[model samples]
Target: MAFKLIFAALAAVSLAASSGAYQLPRSDQLQPLNPPIDNLIPLSAYIDGLLTNAERMKRGMGPARPSKFSDGSVTRREPSSTPTSPSNPEPTDVPTTTPGSGVIRIHDPSSSSTTLYWVSKDLNNFGEYGRTDDISKALTVTLGSDSGRFSIRTPSPACGCVSDLPFLGGIMGYATSGGDLKSSSADYAYLGATVETANGSPAVSGDNSFTRATGISKSIESSIWSISSDNSLTATWINADGAMVDAHILYYAADNVLSLTADPVSFVNNFGASPAVVSSWLSDSTLAVKATAAI
Candidate 1:
């Protein structure tokens, strides 16, 4: 600490009024420690040596620091004040573990969680519906037209897996284009984990707009975004039949595709049941409501 002060003083002097302009008077100050000295010159040199050593020791005690050099000039003056050992509030040992952290554990009040929602919007039209049931397998429904090539994506063993219930409520809406009836589209969502292979199928909701696509169907224009919590992200979904289809489905501007499956047979037959029916399709990738969920 003493060495730091001495260096600071030297540095101040070094930067003081460049050599050319002005001349200042020097003050004769008393020596610190009150020692009766003989040669002031030797004492000054000794003080300098001690400070240099102190500086070196300070640096050596820790990680490498920026290098400092001397200008080789010294001015005679009184010794500086007693070194002021800097005061720090002591380091705060933040916990290294989460939830299960040991030692002086601390909890952040700002922590939060959220539930992802698969919402279905209502678009006053006939809910699209088209599906292929394999006697002992699963049900497969084609998205509106060729919105995307994905069959075997509905709730039923024949379709390969079952559908899912949204984190919140299900959907119920009209379809601009009738599903399966046109063979051009079998509007129905696929429930899965990632989109490829599904844990199970569930009522789908990507498109939400009531308009159709240009040169395509207007029902596919309903597009809405899915949001979630911050701390953790969930990329999995459970099918409606209470099984894990383990498939994934994503929507965006580049890929305008969506599915809606409301068993036309049970549009009214199984209207009110567990994990209600979700019948709706998209002109592109947007999904409309009319889908259902009762759990």
Candidate 2:
């Protein structure tokens, strides 16, 4: 037991002496860890070396060796010229994508059929409409001896253009001959309240002034024409099958074109059957009106 206790005591004392808790060493025991410094590169030269190699490294090239003759000035390399080929010609101005402006619609009262005419404008969508220096000249349409194209039911079937509408012929006639329809007080001269079968069928207004066109026949049954307070003219008619056809024609001097809009208003108002909703040609490209809830 005594031998074991003595061995433990000696072991504790030996650990304490080797644990770095002893007194410090004298200054004579230390030595220099590095060689004497000399011949160091100047701060400017070191910085220039770094800068020179930085540009080369960025360009994926090896750094140049330091030279005594180098002025340490950075020289930028010019960009390489791009090769030109026939397949890669320079770009040019892009063409315009706008559509033509003027359009006209024609309707047939007998058939309740309608046709669209892009009058004055390019029907082929090429670019623009035909420019008319004088709209008065463009509207000067002379009456013809041929039966009217707009006739409903008679010895001859319907035939005529929008200008052939009742009362329009005299208006166009006077306009072409340098007569202003707006200032004309010839109240009941050209037309009367009722159709004068003796004379060519002329469109009569509520005030009884009617004008005759050459081709229009007097066989119209349920046709009515009215002039609005603003001088805008509208003609309504019922087809053979009771379809309501309305033609609204207005003159726009600024655009030098006549805007004629004709459509079938109430198919069931006269015919008594719920007609199918008119689907637009744009339906194919349109999105659904009712949106679905997103997940």
Candidate 3:
């Protein structure tokens, strides 16, 4: 039956060529040839052999034998390198930062010092300073999407009775006077937008200025804030003039302040003619420690 099927396929090909639908070589095309009767095998048997060879290749083994019926052109299907299922997935590198609640610490990148951390100074302002003996002063940070919020683990009367104040008012810039980081109620804030006070007053203006008792609004933070795989923090925003502004955190030693600015050179150059110095632009190694579970 297999031999008859092969002959029928060949006949169809000959018919098509003769109709000028296809061209064939001017040779012994469609000419009947004598089969090697002594060595001839059924087409079904030959197909079974090929299937068997395929199974062997899947098992990462070579073909058992060369074909004797036709040209020795048996190609092997190489095993796929990709994982077939979740049960046997390839290993992947773990990410440094995962979305969720966490606490953040800062250190000196040059020295890898762990003593310094992100702390709330003067009740409302933020700065990177030593918090080695006072863990309560450390800021509990939560980040998701483009938004981030900072709060204290313990509220102190000295620092004001507020516990949940939006860090930097959810915008990247200098701290403003008469503004506290605490709110009388539980509220969230978005980045790159104006903040509001608990009394429905504008907390921080859209221009990054702060008024009394103001906090940012509850919205997704601006895309300006990004955390790299190494936990480096960077801020990129568009100014009113439609120009891109890129900035990194810098520590002003004299004022003990951490401010984000695109130009560190000018800030250092115009250091108020004082003996105070400003640290170099902070990088992930210097600015951020690995995120820890929220306290």
Candidate 4:
């Protein structure tokens, strides 16, 4: 009975093999053990291409499209043709005076001295003063106490103070532009020196001498200046609770004299006279400072 049972099992295996019911899978029929992952590219490559296309479009050129080669290489489409017109020329009416080593001269209205006073940088790093009549010598004076020299720069939109120097790294402008001149710097310090009410008169003070810990009050609006086509600098100061006044770059007689000690120049709204008197002087070009290109 045991021999007959073994024989019956062998017969069943042989019958299945002969009928091709039991067969090993061929190479083509085999399935992958793991699913294939899609190819990945760096994000920076896409960003760079986007920037490049944007610049090309700005220049009046056709936008570039990326193409993939049979060998799995990518390349940008070449421009159909070169741009016919030249890149936009810089505006001719923009102020010719650039931010660099330059001379700032203030008109002296006195009959005794008709020469212009050069705005010399102070050693205190507080404020600038008018001391020298010679333009050549004034340019040699260091801008601030630091080794890096300072230059007058205009922030974007051109509504800020031209006196904004590189030493402080600030954007001096009106409150509407962004923030007040007092809050231009990140540290909440004044650029150069600022004029504020002191004992009922305008006084010049350093960054540390601010009346408030957060620098000048925003309502004062003292440092915002405008440059004209002739390169003349002018500014208007408006007090939220007081009268609006025009800014005049004035200096003390003692500070203007060449001496061993000098004081920073005063930026005042008046010289013990009516505001109209100051306005006339500015209109006649007899009481203003012109920023010119450095020699």
Over 1-295, each residue of candidate 3 has an lDDT whose tens digit, in order, gives 9999999999998998889888644342322111123432222221223336664443233454544536756654433467355575323321122234343444555554445554332332321222222434433344434333221122221232222223333343232222222212111121211222222222323322121122221222133445666665554434434454454444544444444445544444433211212221222333235323322
Instruction: List runs of model 4 lying over 4 Å from the truth.
Output: 1-101, 112-114, 124-128, 139-222, 241-244, 257-295
TM-scores of the candidates are 0.15, 0.17, 0.37, 0.30
Regions of candidate 1 where Cα sits further than 4 Å from its true position: 1-232, 247-252, 255-295
The residue pairs found clashing in candidate 3 are 109-286, 165-181, 191-221, 195-216, 203-214
Look at candidate 4 and tell me the lDDT of residue 233.
49
- Residue 134 of model 3: what lDDT? 44
Could you tell me the C-alpha RMSD of candidate 2 in Å?
A: 42.9
| Model 3 weakest lDDT span, ten residues long | 185-194
Q: How would you encode candidate 2's per-residue C-alpha lDDT over 5-99 as one tens digit per residue?
A: 99998988777779955434443432221112242222222122333566434323246544453777656433236733558532222111112
Candidate 2 residue runs with Cα over 4 Å from true position? 1-224, 248-295
Q: Candidate 1 lDDT, tens digit per residue, 187-293?
A: 33322211222223343433211111111122121111122232111122233344432212222111122223333223212222112222222211111121223
Tens-place lDDT digits, model 4, residues 87-189: 8743433222333324445564544566755544332211222345554333221122212222232221111221222221121211122232121221111
Report the candidate with higher TM-score, 1 versus 2: 2
Best by lDDT: 3
Name the lDDT value of residue 76 in candidate 2.
Answer: 46
